[model samples]
Target: MKFLKIILATAIVLCIVLVATDYWISHKAEGYLYSKVADIPKNKVGLLLGTSKYIATGGINPYYTYRIDAAVALFKAGKIDYILISGDNSHISYNEPDTFKKDLVKRGIPENKIVLDYAGFRTLDSVIRAKKVFGQYSMTIISQKFHNQRAIYIAKNFDIDAIAFNAKDVTNRYGLKTRLREYLARSKAFMDIVFNVGPKFLGEKIPIG
Candidate 1:
């Protein structure tokens, strides 16, 4: 009976901690998120965070489409001179950065204007690599609002001047699952900051002009 009570108490405390951490991260990123193209400040590079183009059900992922749209809009508006595609290339078949580049090209963005970082496996990697690997201390991050919030928080901790262009969000059943997962992700991000965790790969510097 005592063990059962202890387990319950522990679970409750963990839930509280998770919620608190989530709030802290979102609050920290409040002023850094932008939903309109005209309202956002210009930056030399726009960091296009990567995700799978298709979801598990083989449908086009709204998150991917929206991010690409956001990137294109930013470029056309003269808000950013270059688009930095950062994402995972873990498996031979999976190439997030390349996929994004191709789509951006198809959308009429010149190839030279888009640079790829094939090592952004996590949000932390994407944020850190933007500064360490790509020589960008200030950038406009592109993703959904929830994702942008977390990314902005990470950027602030790393001393990067970063703001986010919020892509249109998915609000279906899948979106609900993603939102729930974000709670745990926010907690993990907080711990990553506390522990001074760095990117998994920091290769030779690639200057972006």
Candidate 2:
């Protein structure tokens, strides 16, 4: 009975820690998130965070589509001179950066204006690599609000000047799952900061114009 009570207490403490971390990250990022293209400050590079184009059920992921739309809008509005796609390429069949680049080009963005980082296997990697690998100390991050908040928090710790353009969010059951996952992710991010965790791969620098 005592062991069970201890387990229950531990669970409660963890839940509180998770919720607090989530709030802290989002609050830290409040002033940096913009929903409108006209309101955001322009940057030389817009870092489009990557996700799979399709969900596991074989439907187009709204997160992917909305991020692409946001990136295109930012480019056309002259808010960003280049689109740097950062995503995972861990598997031979999975190429997030390439997929995003193709979609952005199809949506009227010039191929030359898009840059790809094939090592952004995690959000931490994406945020840090923007500076360490891509030579961008300041950038406009493009993703959903929840994701942007976490990324901005990471950026601030790394001494990168970053703001985020919020992509249209998914509102279905999947969205709820993603949001719940984000709470844990935010907690992990806080711990990552505390421990000075870094990108898994930091290769030769690639300058972005």
**Best model per lDDT:** 1
Could you give candidate 1's per-residue lDDT for residues 87-205 as a string of tens digits? 99999999999999999999999999999999999999999999999999999999999999999999999999999999999999999999999999999999999999999999999
- lDDT string for model 2 (93-159, tens) is 9999999988888999999899999999999999999999999999999999999999999999999
lDDT for each of the candidates? 0.96, 0.96
| Model 1 regions more than 4 Å off | none
Model 1 residue 61 distance off true place after TM-score fit, in angstroms? 0.8
Can you tell me which runs of candidate 2 are displaced by over 4 Å?
none
Candidate 1 has an lDDT of 0.96
**Clashing residue pairs, candidate 1?**
none
TM-score for predicted model 1 compared with the true structure? 0.99
Residue 137 error for model 1, in Å? 0.8
54 in model 2: Cα distance from truth in Å?
Answer: 0.7
